[model samples]
Target: MGPTEWTAREEVGVGPWSGEWPADDRYDPDLLAGGDRRNVMDAYRYWRREAIVADVDRRRHPFHVAIENFQHDHNIGTVVRTANAFAAAAVHIVGRRRWNRRGAMVTDRYQHLEHHPDVASLAKFATERGLSIVAVDNTPGAQPVETAVLPRECVLLFGQEGPGLSEEAQASASFVVSIAQFGTTRSINAGVAAGIVMHTWIRHHADLSSAW
Candidate 1:
Protein backbone atom coordinates (compact mmCIF):
# COMPACT_ATOMS: atom_id res chain seq x y z
CA MET A 1 0.00 0.00 0.00
CA GLY A 2 1.12 3.55 -0.66
CA PRO A 3 2.28 5.79 2.18
CA THR A 4 -0.41 7.97 3.81
CA GLU A 5 -0.65 11.47 2.34
CA TRP A 6 -0.56 13.13 5.77
CA THR A 7 2.63 11.23 6.50
CA ALA A 8 4.20 12.88 3.47
CA ARG A 9 2.77 16.35 4.18
CA GLU A 10 3.48 18.74 7.02
CA GLU A 11 0.57 18.67 9.48
CA VAL A 12 0.37 22.39 10.22
CA GLY A 13 2.00 25.45 8.73
CA VAL A 14 1.34 28.34 6.37
CA GLY A 15 -0.28 27.40 3.13
CA PRO A 16 1.19 28.17 -0.33
CA TRP A 17 2.19 31.72 -1.13
CA SER A 18 -0.68 33.53 -2.84
CA GLY A 19 1.38 36.09 -4.78
CA GLU A 20 4.75 37.83 -4.91
CA TRP A 21 7.75 36.34 -3.15
CA PRO A 22 9.88 38.07 -0.57
CA ALA A 23 13.21 39.61 -1.58
CA ASP A 24 15.22 37.69 1.04
CA ASP A 25 17.34 34.95 -0.45
CA ARG A 26 17.08 33.02 2.78
CA TYR A 27 13.52 31.90 2.01
CA ASP A 28 13.22 28.65 0.11
CA PRO A 29 10.95 28.97 -2.93
CA ASP A 30 9.50 25.50 -2.55
CA LEU A 31 8.65 26.00 1.11
CA LEU A 32 7.03 29.35 0.43
CA ALA A 33 4.88 27.95 -2.35
CA GLY A 34 3.90 24.90 -0.31
CA GLY A 35 3.51 25.78 3.40
CA ASP A 36 6.44 25.26 5.72
CA ARG A 37 5.64 22.94 8.58
CA ARG A 38 9.12 21.83 9.42
CA ASN A 39 9.96 21.21 13.06
CA VAL A 40 11.97 24.43 13.01
CA MET A 41 10.90 27.47 14.99
CA ASP A 42 8.53 29.92 13.34
CA ALA A 43 11.33 32.47 12.99
CA TYR A 44 12.91 29.99 10.59
CA ARG A 45 9.78 29.03 8.71
CA TYR A 46 10.16 29.11 4.92
CA TRP A 47 13.87 29.82 5.32
CA ARG A 48 16.35 27.86 3.28
CA ARG A 49 17.93 25.00 5.18
CA GLU A 50 21.43 26.42 4.77
CA ALA A 51 20.22 29.87 5.73
CA ILE A 52 18.77 28.62 8.99
CA VAL A 53 21.99 26.75 9.70
CA ALA A 54 24.05 29.87 9.06
CA ASP A 55 21.88 31.89 11.43
CA VAL A 56 22.20 29.23 14.11
CA ASP A 57 25.97 29.08 13.69
CA ARG A 58 26.26 32.82 14.16
CA ARG A 59 24.54 32.59 17.54
CA ARG A 60 25.59 29.21 18.92
CA HIS A 61 27.08 28.99 22.40
CA PRO A 62 30.77 28.37 23.00
CA PHE A 63 30.29 24.99 24.63
CA HIS A 64 30.35 21.81 22.53
CA VAL A 65 28.75 18.39 23.19
CA ALA A 66 30.46 15.03 22.85
CA ILE A 67 29.18 11.49 23.34
CA GLU A 68 30.82 8.08 23.44
CA ASN A 69 29.02 5.76 21.02
CA PHE A 70 30.82 2.52 21.81
CA GLN A 71 27.63 0.43 21.79
CA HIS A 72 25.61 2.32 19.21
CA ASP A 73 23.43 3.62 22.02
CA HIS A 74 20.05 4.73 20.77
CA ASN A 75 20.04 7.78 23.04
CA ILE A 76 22.72 9.45 20.96
CA GLY A 77 20.06 10.83 18.65
CA THR A 78 18.25 12.47 21.56
CA VAL A 79 21.52 14.03 22.64
CA VAL A 80 21.97 15.46 19.17
CA ARG A 81 18.44 16.82 19.18
CA THR A 82 18.91 18.47 22.57
CA ALA A 83 22.24 19.90 21.46
CA ASN A 84 20.50 21.53 18.54
CA ALA A 85 17.72 22.84 20.76
CA PHE A 86 20.26 24.35 23.16
CA ALA A 87 22.27 25.81 20.30
CA ALA A 88 25.45 23.95 21.17
CA ALA A 89 28.47 24.95 19.08
CA ALA A 90 28.90 21.43 17.73
CA VAL A 91 28.57 17.74 18.52
CA HIS A 92 31.38 15.20 18.50
CA ILE A 93 30.70 11.48 18.37
CA VAL A 94 33.48 9.26 19.65
CA GLY A 95 33.59 5.62 18.60
CA ARG A 96 31.35 3.78 16.10
CA ARG A 97 30.83 5.88 12.97
CA ARG A 98 27.16 5.03 12.50
CA TRP A 99 24.52 5.97 15.09
CA ASN A 100 20.76 5.66 15.44
CA ARG A 101 19.17 8.99 14.42
CA ARG A 102 15.54 8.04 14.98
CA GLY A 103 15.25 10.22 18.06
CA ALA A 104 16.75 13.33 16.51
CA MET A 105 13.63 14.02 14.38
CA VAL A 106 15.85 15.40 11.58
CA THR A 107 17.31 18.20 13.71
CA ASP A 108 20.81 16.96 12.94
CA ARG A 109 20.56 18.63 9.57
CA TYR A 110 20.88 22.06 11.24
CA GLN A 111 23.76 21.06 13.47
CA HIS A 112 27.47 20.46 12.86
CA LEU A 113 28.81 17.02 13.76
CA GLU A 114 32.23 15.39 13.81
CA HIS A 115 33.25 11.77 14.36
CA HIS A 116 36.39 10.41 15.99
CA PRO A 117 37.50 6.83 16.37
CA ASP A 118 38.01 7.01 20.13
CA VAL A 119 37.87 9.16 23.23
CA ALA A 120 41.58 9.95 22.88
CA SER A 121 41.02 11.50 19.50
CA LEU A 122 38.07 13.46 20.87
CA ALA A 123 40.36 14.72 23.66
CA LYS A 124 42.88 15.87 21.08
CA PHE A 125 40.21 17.79 19.23
CA ALA A 126 39.20 19.45 22.50
CA THR A 127 42.79 20.48 23.17
CA GLU A 128 43.18 22.00 19.74
CA ARG A 129 40.03 24.01 20.23
CA GLY A 130 40.88 25.14 23.80
CA LEU A 131 37.87 23.32 25.24
CA SER A 132 38.03 21.48 28.54
CA ILE A 133 36.48 18.02 28.69
CA VAL A 134 33.76 17.95 31.33
CA ALA A 135 32.46 14.44 31.80
CA VAL A 136 29.00 13.65 33.22
CA ASP A 137 28.27 10.56 35.31
CA ASN A 138 27.08 9.56 38.75
CA THR A 139 30.27 7.79 39.77
CA PRO A 140 31.88 8.40 43.14
CA GLY A 141 33.76 11.67 43.73
CA ALA A 142 31.76 13.40 41.04
CA GLN A 143 30.80 16.95 42.02
CA PRO A 144 27.13 17.85 42.05
CA VAL A 145 26.54 19.75 38.83
CA GLU A 146 24.04 22.04 40.60
CA THR A 147 26.74 23.60 42.73
CA ALA A 148 29.82 23.21 40.58
CA VAL A 149 30.70 26.15 38.43
CA LEU A 150 30.63 24.60 34.97
CA PRO A 151 33.07 26.01 32.47
CA ARG A 152 31.41 28.33 29.99
CA GLU A 153 33.62 27.06 27.26
CA CYS A 154 34.02 23.32 27.28
CA VAL A 155 32.94 20.03 25.80
CA LEU A 156 30.26 18.23 27.84
CA LEU A 157 30.89 14.52 27.44
CA PHE A 158 28.41 11.72 28.11
CA GLY A 159 28.89 8.00 27.86
CA GLN A 160 26.58 5.10 27.07
CA GLU A 161 23.31 5.00 29.05
CA GLY A 162 24.08 1.99 31.22
CA PRO A 163 27.86 2.05 31.78
CA GLY A 164 28.14 5.83 32.05
CA LEU A 165 31.57 7.27 31.31
CA SER A 166 34.36 4.80 30.70
CA GLU A 167 37.59 4.93 32.77
CA GLU A 168 39.57 6.45 29.94
CA ALA A 169 36.80 8.96 29.35
CA GLN A 170 36.72 9.83 33.05
CA ALA A 171 40.50 10.21 33.36
CA SER A 172 40.60 12.57 30.41
CA ALA A 173 38.02 14.93 31.91
CA SER A 174 39.08 18.18 33.56
CA PHE A 175 35.97 17.90 35.73
CA VAL A 176 33.36 15.23 36.32
CA VAL A 177 29.87 15.89 37.66
CA SER A 178 26.75 14.02 38.75
CA ILE A 179 23.17 15.20 38.85
CA ALA A 180 21.30 14.95 42.14
CA GLN A 181 18.74 12.19 42.19
CA PHE A 182 16.19 11.25 44.86
CA GLY A 183 14.53 8.47 42.93
CA THR A 184 15.45 4.83 43.33
CA THR A 185 16.80 4.52 39.82
CA ARG A 186 20.53 3.81 39.68
CA SER A 187 20.96 6.44 37.00
CA ILE A 188 19.01 8.52 34.51
CA ASN A 189 18.73 8.11 30.78
CA ALA A 190 21.58 9.66 28.80
CA GLY A 191 19.24 11.92 26.86
CA VAL A 192 17.55 13.24 30.02
CA ALA A 193 20.94 13.64 31.69
CA ALA A 194 22.19 15.72 28.80
CA GLY A 195 19.21 18.08 29.08
CA ILE A 196 19.65 18.62 32.81
CA VAL A 197 23.34 19.36 32.45
CA MET A 198 22.76 21.64 29.51
CA HIS A 199 20.10 23.54 31.44
CA THR A 200 22.44 23.89 34.39
CA TRP A 201 25.05 25.34 32.10
CA ILE A 202 22.48 27.62 30.58
CA ARG A 203 21.34 28.86 33.97
CA HIS A 204 24.91 29.71 34.95
CA HIS A 205 26.25 30.88 31.61
CA ALA A 206 23.73 31.48 28.86
CA ASP A 207 22.24 34.93 28.28
CA LEU A 208 18.52 34.45 28.77
CA SER A 209 17.58 37.92 27.57
CA SER A 210 18.23 36.95 23.96
CA ALA A 211 16.34 33.70 23.90
CA TRP A 212 13.10 33.29 21.96
Candidate 2:
Protein backbone atom coordinates (compact mmCIF):
# COMPACT_ATOMS: atom_id res chain seq x y z
CA MET A 1 0.00 0.00 0.00
CA GLY A 2 1.03 3.59 -0.58
CA PRO A 3 1.99 5.80 2.38
CA THR A 4 -1.38 7.55 2.44
CA GLU A 5 -3.27 4.28 1.93
CA TRP A 6 -1.40 2.48 4.69
CA THR A 7 -3.23 2.11 7.97
CA ALA A 8 -1.63 3.45 11.12
CA ARG A 9 -0.16 0.67 13.25
CA GLU A 10 -2.40 1.48 16.19
CA GLU A 11 -5.44 1.84 14.00
CA VAL A 12 -4.99 -1.29 11.85
CA GLY A 13 -5.12 -5.07 12.47
CA VAL A 14 -7.77 -7.31 13.95
CA GLY A 15 -9.87 -6.47 16.95
CA PRO A 16 -11.05 -8.66 19.82
CA TRP A 17 -13.29 -11.56 18.90
CA SER A 18 -16.94 -11.07 19.57
CA GLY A 19 -17.81 -14.72 18.96
CA GLU A 20 -16.34 -18.21 19.04
CA TRP A 21 -12.60 -18.35 18.44
CA PRO A 22 -10.60 -20.57 16.10
CA ALA A 23 -9.51 -23.90 17.60
CA ASP A 24 -5.99 -23.82 16.16
CA ASP A 25 -3.21 -24.15 18.70
CA ARG A 26 -1.21 -21.60 16.78
CA TYR A 27 -3.87 -19.02 17.58
CA ASP A 28 -3.32 -17.15 20.81
CA PRO A 29 -6.44 -17.07 22.94
CA ASP A 30 -5.58 -13.71 24.44
CA LEU A 31 -4.97 -12.16 21.05
CA LEU A 32 -8.10 -13.67 19.56
CA ALA A 33 -10.17 -12.48 22.49
CA GLY A 34 -8.60 -9.04 22.82
CA GLY A 35 -7.68 -7.44 19.50
CA ASP A 36 -4.54 -8.56 17.72
CA ARG A 37 -3.46 -5.26 16.26
CA ARG A 38 0.17 -6.30 16.02
CA ASN A 39 2.36 -5.19 13.13
CA VAL A 40 2.23 -8.60 11.50
CA MET A 41 0.96 -9.80 8.15
CA ASP A 42 -2.69 -10.63 7.62
CA ALA A 43 -2.08 -14.38 7.67
CA TYR A 44 -0.47 -13.97 11.07
CA ARG A 45 -2.97 -11.54 12.50
CA TYR A 46 -4.11 -13.69 15.43
CA TRP A 47 -1.25 -16.18 15.46
CA ARG A 48 0.76 -16.74 18.60
CA ARG A 49 4.10 -14.99 18.61
CA GLU A 50 5.85 -18.23 19.43
CA ALA A 51 3.97 -20.04 16.68
CA ILE A 52 4.90 -17.39 14.15
CA VAL A 53 8.54 -17.65 15.18
CA ALA A 54 8.45 -21.42 14.84
CA ASP A 55 7.05 -21.12 11.33
CA VAL A 56 9.63 -18.54 10.33
CA ASP A 57 12.43 -20.62 11.76
CA ARG A 58 11.28 -23.63 9.77
CA ARG A 59 11.89 -21.80 6.50
CA ARG A 60 14.54 -19.19 7.22
CA HIS A 61 17.12 -18.39 4.54
CA PRO A 62 20.49 -20.14 4.64
CA PHE A 63 22.52 -16.96 4.66
CA HIS A 64 23.12 -14.78 7.69
CA VAL A 65 23.69 -11.04 8.14
CA ALA A 66 26.18 -9.53 10.54
CA ILE A 67 27.00 -5.99 11.57
CA GLU A 68 30.10 -4.85 13.44
CA ASN A 69 28.59 -2.67 16.12
CA PHE A 70 31.72 -1.07 17.55
CA GLN A 71 30.14 2.35 17.08
CA HIS A 72 26.62 1.62 18.32
CA ASP A 73 25.24 2.56 14.93
CA HIS A 74 21.50 3.15 14.77
CA ASN A 75 21.55 1.46 11.39
CA ILE A 76 21.91 -1.88 13.16
CA GLY A 77 18.21 -1.90 13.96
CA THR A 78 17.35 -1.30 10.33
CA VAL A 79 19.71 -4.07 9.30
CA VAL A 80 18.10 -6.45 11.77
CA ARG A 81 14.66 -5.49 10.52
CA THR A 82 15.71 -6.06 6.94
CA ALA A 83 17.24 -9.38 7.90
CA ASN A 84 13.89 -10.38 9.33
CA ALA A 85 12.13 -9.27 6.15
CA PHE A 86 14.57 -11.31 4.04
CA ALA A 87 14.12 -14.29 6.36
CA ALA A 88 17.81 -14.46 7.16
CA ALA A 89 18.89 -17.37 9.30
CA ALA A 90 20.02 -14.89 11.94
CA VAL A 91 21.41 -11.41 12.50
CA HIS A 92 24.75 -11.23 14.25
CA ILE A 93 25.81 -8.18 16.21
CA VAL A 94 29.50 -8.03 17.00
CA GLY A 95 31.03 -5.82 19.70
CA ARG A 96 27.69 -4.86 21.22
CA ARG A 97 25.23 -6.93 23.19
CA ARG A 98 22.65 -4.17 23.48
CA TRP A 99 21.35 -2.41 20.36
CA ASN A 100 18.54 0.02 19.64
CA ARG A 101 15.55 -2.04 18.51
CA ARG A 102 13.02 0.64 17.62
CA GLY A 103 13.53 0.29 13.88
CA ALA A 104 12.89 -3.45 14.03
CA MET A 105 9.18 -2.83 14.63
CA VAL A 106 9.04 -5.92 16.89
CA THR A 107 10.23 -8.10 13.99
CA ASP A 108 13.30 -8.93 16.05
CA ARG A 109 11.05 -11.02 18.25
CA TYR A 110 10.39 -13.33 15.30
CA GLN A 111 13.96 -13.42 14.03
CA HIS A 112 17.03 -15.16 15.41
CA LEU A 113 19.69 -12.82 16.81
CA GLU A 114 23.14 -13.41 18.25
CA HIS A 115 25.84 -11.23 19.77
CA HIS A 116 29.59 -11.76 19.59
CA PRO A 117 32.22 -9.92 21.58
CA ASP A 118 34.42 -9.11 18.58
CA VAL A 119 35.08 -9.76 14.93
CA ALA A 120 37.40 -12.65 15.71
CA SER A 121 34.73 -14.51 17.62
CA LEU A 122 32.26 -13.95 14.85
CA ALA A 123 34.80 -15.25 12.36
CA LYS A 124 35.36 -18.36 14.45
CA PHE A 125 31.62 -18.97 14.71
CA ALA A 126 31.14 -18.70 10.96
CA THR A 127 34.12 -20.95 10.33
CA GLU A 128 32.81 -23.62 12.65
CA ARG A 129 29.39 -23.38 11.03
CA GLY A 130 30.90 -23.84 7.57
CA LEU A 131 29.64 -20.49 6.38
CA SER A 132 31.85 -18.07 4.47
CA ILE A 133 32.42 -14.57 5.78
CA VAL A 134 31.55 -12.06 3.07
CA ALA A 135 32.16 -8.45 3.96
CA VAL A 136 30.50 -5.46 2.30
CA ASP A 137 32.87 -2.53 2.06
CA ASN A 138 33.99 0.00 -0.53
CA THR A 139 37.65 -0.72 0.23
CA PRO A 140 40.26 -1.23 -2.46
CA GLY A 141 40.89 -4.71 -4.01
CA ALA A 142 37.30 -5.57 -3.23
CA GLN A 143 35.23 -6.87 -6.13
CA PRO A 144 31.92 -5.34 -7.12
CA VAL A 145 29.04 -7.30 -5.59
CA GLU A 146 27.05 -6.78 -8.76
CA THR A 147 29.52 -9.09 -10.55
CA ALA A 148 30.96 -11.18 -7.75
CA VAL A 149 29.29 -14.48 -7.04
CA LEU A 150 28.07 -14.50 -3.42
CA PRO A 151 28.13 -17.70 -1.45
CA ARG A 152 24.86 -19.53 -1.07
CA GLU A 153 25.45 -19.77 2.65
CA CYS A 154 27.49 -16.89 3.98
CA VAL A 155 27.64 -14.31 6.68
CA LEU A 156 27.27 -10.90 5.03
CA LEU A 157 29.36 -8.67 7.30
CA PHE A 158 28.88 -4.92 7.52
CA GLY A 159 30.47 -2.13 9.47
CA GLN A 160 29.19 1.15 10.84
CA GLU A 161 27.94 4.02 8.68
CA GLY A 162 30.81 6.51 8.50
CA PRO A 163 34.01 4.51 9.16
CA GLY A 164 32.94 1.34 7.28
CA LEU A 165 34.41 -2.07 8.18
CA SER A 166 37.29 -2.33 10.60
CA GLU A 167 40.60 -3.64 9.27
CA GLU A 168 40.31 -6.78 11.34
CA ALA A 169 36.78 -7.27 10.10
CA GLN A 170 37.99 -6.90 6.55
CA ALA A 171 40.85 -9.32 7.21
CA SER A 172 38.43 -11.85 8.63
CA ALA A 173 36.40 -11.80 5.43
CA SER A 174 36.89 -14.61 2.94
CA PHE A 175 35.59 -12.20 0.33
CA VAL A 176 34.77 -8.50 0.30
CA VAL A 177 32.56 -6.90 -2.32
CA SER A 178 31.54 -3.29 -2.71
CA ILE A 179 28.28 -1.91 -3.98
CA ALA A 180 28.70 0.28 -7.05
CA GLN A 181 27.82 3.90 -6.47
CA PHE A 182 27.91 6.45 -9.30
CA GLY A 183 27.20 9.52 -7.18
CA THR A 184 29.65 11.74 -5.35
CA THR A 185 28.84 9.98 -2.08
CA ARG A 186 31.76 7.76 -1.17
CA SER A 187 29.49 5.15 0.39
CA ILE A 188 25.94 4.34 1.31
CA ASN A 189 24.28 3.77 4.67
CA ALA A 190 25.05 0.39 6.25
CA GLY A 191 21.35 -0.39 6.51
CA VAL A 192 20.76 0.33 2.82
CA ALA A 193 23.90 -1.58 1.86
CA ALA A 194 22.80 -4.59 3.86
CA GLY A 195 19.43 -4.60 2.12
CA ILE A 196 21.06 -4.40 -1.30
CA VAL A 197 23.53 -7.18 -0.57
CA MET A 198 20.89 -9.47 0.93
CA HIS A 199 18.54 -8.93 -2.00
CA THR A 200 21.39 -9.66 -4.38
CA TRP A 201 22.02 -12.97 -2.68
CA ILE A 202 18.31 -13.67 -2.75
CA ARG A 203 18.16 -12.88 -6.43
CA HIS A 204 20.77 -15.50 -7.20
CA HIS A 205 19.65 -18.21 -4.81
CA ALA A 206 16.05 -17.85 -3.58
CA ASP A 207 13.26 -19.68 -5.37
CA LEU A 208 10.84 -17.09 -6.63
CA SER A 209 7.99 -19.58 -6.93
CA SER A 210 8.16 -20.17 -3.19
CA ALA A 211 7.36 -16.55 -2.51
CA TRP A 212 3.98 -14.88 -3.04
Candidate 3:
Protein backbone atom coordinates (compact mmCIF):
# COMPACT_ATOMS: atom_id res chain seq x y z
CA MET A 1 0.00 0.00 0.00
CA GLY A 2 1.08 3.57 -0.61
CA PRO A 3 1.75 6.08 2.17
CA THR A 4 -1.71 7.55 1.90
CA GLU A 5 -3.49 4.28 2.45
CA TRP A 6 -1.05 2.44 4.70
CA THR A 7 -2.81 3.34 7.98
CA ALA A 8 -6.26 2.56 6.67
CA ARG A 9 -6.22 -0.86 8.22
CA GLU A 10 -8.58 -0.96 11.18
CA GLU A 11 -6.73 -0.61 14.43
CA VAL A 12 -7.01 -3.95 16.27
CA GLY A 13 -7.04 -2.72 19.89
CA VAL A 14 -7.59 0.70 21.34
CA GLY A 15 -10.21 2.81 23.14
CA PRO A 16 -10.78 3.22 26.90
CA TRP A 17 -9.89 0.36 29.28
CA SER A 18 -8.13 -1.67 26.56
CA GLY A 19 -4.80 -1.64 28.35
CA GLU A 20 -2.99 -0.45 31.46
CA TRP A 21 -1.24 2.89 31.68
CA PRO A 22 2.30 3.05 30.35
CA ALA A 23 5.14 2.90 32.88
CA ASP A 24 5.88 6.43 31.81
CA ASP A 25 2.60 8.15 31.23
CA ARG A 26 3.92 11.28 29.70
CA TYR A 27 0.43 12.39 28.77
CA ASP A 28 -2.40 13.54 30.97
CA PRO A 29 -4.99 10.87 31.75
CA ASP A 30 -7.74 13.38 31.17
CA LEU A 31 -6.27 13.93 27.70
CA LEU A 32 -5.98 10.22 26.94
CA ALA A 33 -9.46 9.51 28.28
CA GLY A 34 -10.85 12.29 26.19
CA GLY A 35 -10.25 10.38 22.93
CA ASP A 36 -6.58 11.24 22.42
CA ARG A 37 -7.16 14.58 20.72
CA ARG A 38 -3.47 14.75 19.79
CA ASN A 39 -2.31 14.84 16.16
CA VAL A 40 -1.23 11.21 15.78
CA MET A 41 -2.89 9.02 13.13
CA ASP A 42 -5.92 6.78 13.81
CA ALA A 43 -4.00 3.53 14.32
CA TYR A 44 -2.53 4.90 17.53
CA ARG A 45 -5.64 6.55 18.88
CA TYR A 46 -6.42 5.74 22.52
CA TRP A 47 -3.72 3.08 22.76
CA ARG A 48 -1.78 2.87 25.99
CA ARG A 49 1.15 5.26 25.88
CA GLU A 50 3.90 2.66 26.18
CA ALA A 51 2.42 0.50 23.42
CA ILE A 52 2.92 3.23 20.90
CA VAL A 53 6.50 3.87 22.02
CA ALA A 54 7.34 0.18 21.92
CA ASP A 55 5.96 -0.18 18.40
CA VAL A 56 8.00 2.76 17.21
CA ASP A 57 11.16 1.50 18.87
CA ARG A 58 10.81 -1.88 17.21
CA ARG A 59 10.97 -0.32 13.75
CA ARG A 60 13.32 2.58 14.37
CA HIS A 61 16.03 3.26 11.79
CA PRO A 62 19.74 3.03 12.48
CA PHE A 63 20.41 6.72 11.90
CA HIS A 64 20.22 9.21 14.78
CA VAL A 65 19.34 12.94 14.73
CA ALA A 66 21.03 15.74 16.67
CA ILE A 67 20.14 19.43 16.74
CA GLU A 68 21.74 22.37 18.50
CA ASN A 69 19.24 23.81 20.98
CA PHE A 70 21.13 26.76 22.34
CA GLN A 71 18.48 29.24 21.21
CA HIS A 72 15.37 27.36 22.40
CA ASP A 73 14.29 27.33 18.77
CA HIS A 74 10.58 26.85 18.11
CA ASN A 75 11.18 24.50 15.22
CA ILE A 76 12.50 21.75 17.50
CA GLY A 77 9.05 20.27 17.91
CA THR A 78 8.50 19.97 14.20
CA VAL A 79 11.92 18.39 13.80
CA VAL A 80 11.09 15.87 16.53
CA ARG A 81 7.83 14.91 14.87
CA THR A 82 9.55 14.41 11.55
CA ALA A 83 12.21 12.27 13.18
CA ASN A 84 9.50 10.08 14.70
CA ALA A 85 7.77 9.73 11.35
CA PHE A 86 11.03 8.57 9.79
CA ALA A 87 11.64 6.16 12.69
CA ALA A 88 15.00 7.61 13.64
CA ALA A 89 17.07 5.74 16.24
CA ALA A 90 17.11 8.70 18.64
CA VAL A 91 17.25 12.49 18.83
CA HIS A 92 20.10 14.23 20.66
CA ILE A 93 19.53 17.76 21.90
CA VAL A 94 22.83 19.60 22.09
CA GLY A 95 23.35 22.59 24.36
CA ARG A 96 19.93 22.60 26.04
CA ARG A 97 18.03 20.27 28.33
CA ARG A 98 14.51 21.30 27.40
CA TRP A 99 12.61 22.47 24.31
CA ASN A 100 9.01 23.26 23.48
CA ARG A 101 7.08 20.24 22.21
CA ARG A 102 3.87 21.96 21.14
CA GLY A 103 4.70 21.41 17.47
CA ALA A 104 5.46 17.76 18.09
CA MET A 105 1.78 17.28 18.98
CA VAL A 106 2.85 14.78 21.64
CA THR A 107 4.62 12.51 19.17
CA ASP A 108 7.72 12.81 21.37
CA ARG A 109 6.42 9.79 23.25
CA TYR A 110 7.28 7.64 20.25
CA GLN A 111 10.71 9.15 19.72
CA HIS A 112 13.75 8.48 21.92
CA LEU A 113 15.36 11.75 22.94
CA GLU A 114 18.76 12.34 24.58
CA HIS A 115 20.13 15.52 26.07
CA HIS A 116 23.74 16.65 25.63
CA PRO A 117 25.37 19.56 27.36
CA ASP A 118 27.16 20.58 24.15
CA VAL A 119 28.16 19.54 20.68
CA ALA A 120 31.26 17.81 22.03
CA SER A 121 29.16 15.51 24.18
CA LEU A 122 26.90 14.67 21.26
CA ALA A 123 29.92 13.91 19.06
CA LYS A 124 31.29 11.67 21.80
CA PHE A 125 28.08 9.63 21.92
CA ALA A 126 28.01 9.10 18.14
CA THR A 127 31.70 8.30 17.96
CA GLU A 128 31.43 5.77 20.77
CA ARG A 129 28.72 3.99 18.77
CA GLY A 130 30.87 4.07 15.62
CA LEU A 131 28.44 6.47 13.97
CA SER A 132 29.84 9.33 11.91
CA ILE A 133 28.46 12.77 12.76
CA VAL A 134 27.40 14.83 9.74
CA ALA A 135 26.35 18.43 10.08
CA VAL A 136 23.87 20.15 7.75
CA ASP A 137 24.86 23.70 6.93
CA ASN A 138 25.45 26.06 3.99
CA THR A 139 28.96 27.22 4.82
CA PRO A 140 31.54 27.57 2.03
CA GLY A 141 33.20 24.33 3.07
CA ALA A 142 30.01 22.23 3.11
CA GLN A 143 29.48 19.56 0.47
CA PRO A 144 26.18 19.48 -1.46
CA VAL A 145 24.05 16.83 0.22
CA GLU A 146 22.35 15.87 -3.04
CA THR A 147 25.61 14.65 -4.51
CA ALA A 148 27.48 13.53 -1.42
CA VAL A 149 27.64 9.98 -0.12
CA LEU A 150 25.86 9.71 3.25
CA PRO A 151 27.07 7.11 5.71
CA ARG A 152 24.79 4.15 6.48
CA GLU A 153 25.41 4.65 10.17
CA CYS A 154 25.60 8.31 11.04
CA VAL A 155 24.01 11.14 12.98
CA LEU A 156 22.52 14.03 10.97
CA LEU A 157 23.05 17.21 12.96
CA PHE A 158 21.36 20.58 12.44
CA GLY A 159 21.44 23.99 14.00
CA GLN A 160 19.21 27.02 14.51
CA GLU A 161 17.46 28.96 11.70
CA GLY A 162 19.34 32.22 11.21
CA PRO A 163 22.81 31.24 12.42
CA GLY A 164 22.61 27.82 10.71
CA LEU A 165 25.23 25.95 12.80
CA SER A 166 27.44 26.60 15.77
CA GLU A 167 31.18 26.81 15.13
CA GLU A 168 31.72 24.00 17.57
CA ALA A 169 29.15 21.73 15.88
CA GLN A 170 30.68 22.24 12.45
CA ALA A 171 34.08 21.42 13.83
CA SER A 172 32.81 18.31 15.57
CA ALA A 173 31.23 16.78 12.50
CA SER A 174 33.23 14.42 10.30
CA PHE A 175 31.84 16.39 7.35
CA VAL A 176 29.35 19.16 6.79
CA VAL A 177 26.67 18.90 4.07
CA SER A 178 24.45 21.50 2.40
CA ILE A 179 21.12 21.09 0.66
CA ALA A 180 20.94 22.56 -2.83
CA GLN A 181 18.97 25.80 -3.13
CA PHE A 182 18.45 28.29 -5.92
CA GLY A 183 16.03 30.59 -4.20
CA THR A 184 17.01 33.97 -2.84
CA THR A 185 16.46 32.96 0.76
CA ARG A 186 19.75 32.54 2.60
CA SER A 187 18.30 29.52 4.39
CA ILE A 188 15.16 27.47 4.77
CA ASN A 189 13.26 26.88 8.00
CA ALA A 190 15.28 24.66 10.33
CA GLY A 191 12.51 22.05 10.47
CA VAL A 192 12.26 21.86 6.69
CA ALA A 193 16.01 21.57 6.38
CA ALA A 194 15.98 18.69 8.85
CA GLY A 195 13.28 16.86 6.91
CA ILE A 196 15.26 17.20 3.69
CA VAL A 197 18.42 15.81 5.22
CA MET A 198 16.55 12.96 6.91
CA HIS A 199 14.69 11.94 3.76
CA THR A 200 17.95 12.00 1.86
CA TRP A 201 19.46 9.67 4.41
CA ILE A 202 16.45 7.36 4.21
CA ARG A 203 16.70 7.15 0.43
CA HIS A 204 20.32 6.10 0.51
CA HIS A 205 20.35 3.89 3.61
CA ALA A 206 16.88 2.53 4.46
CA ASP A 207 15.36 -0.52 2.86
CA LEU A 208 12.28 0.95 1.21
CA SER A 209 11.08 -2.44 0.09
CA SER A 210 10.43 -3.32 3.72
CA ALA A 211 9.09 0.05 4.94
CA TRP A 212 5.40 0.04 5.72
lDDT of each: 0.90, 0.89, 0.83
RMSD of each: 4.7, 3.8, 6.3
* lDDT (Cα, 0-100) at 66 in candidate 3: 91
TM-score per candidate, in order? Answer: 0.94, 0.93, 0.82
Model 3 spans > 4 angstroms off? 1-36
- What would the per-residue lDDT of candidate 2 be over residues 10-93, giving only the tens digit for each residue? 476767765667778998888776677778877787799999999888888899999988878999889988998889999999
**C-alpha RMSD between model 2 and the true structure:** 3.8
Which candidate number maximizes lDDT? Answer: 1
Error of 3 at 166 (Å): 1.1
**lDDT score for residue 158 of model 1:** 96
lDDT value for model 1: 0.90
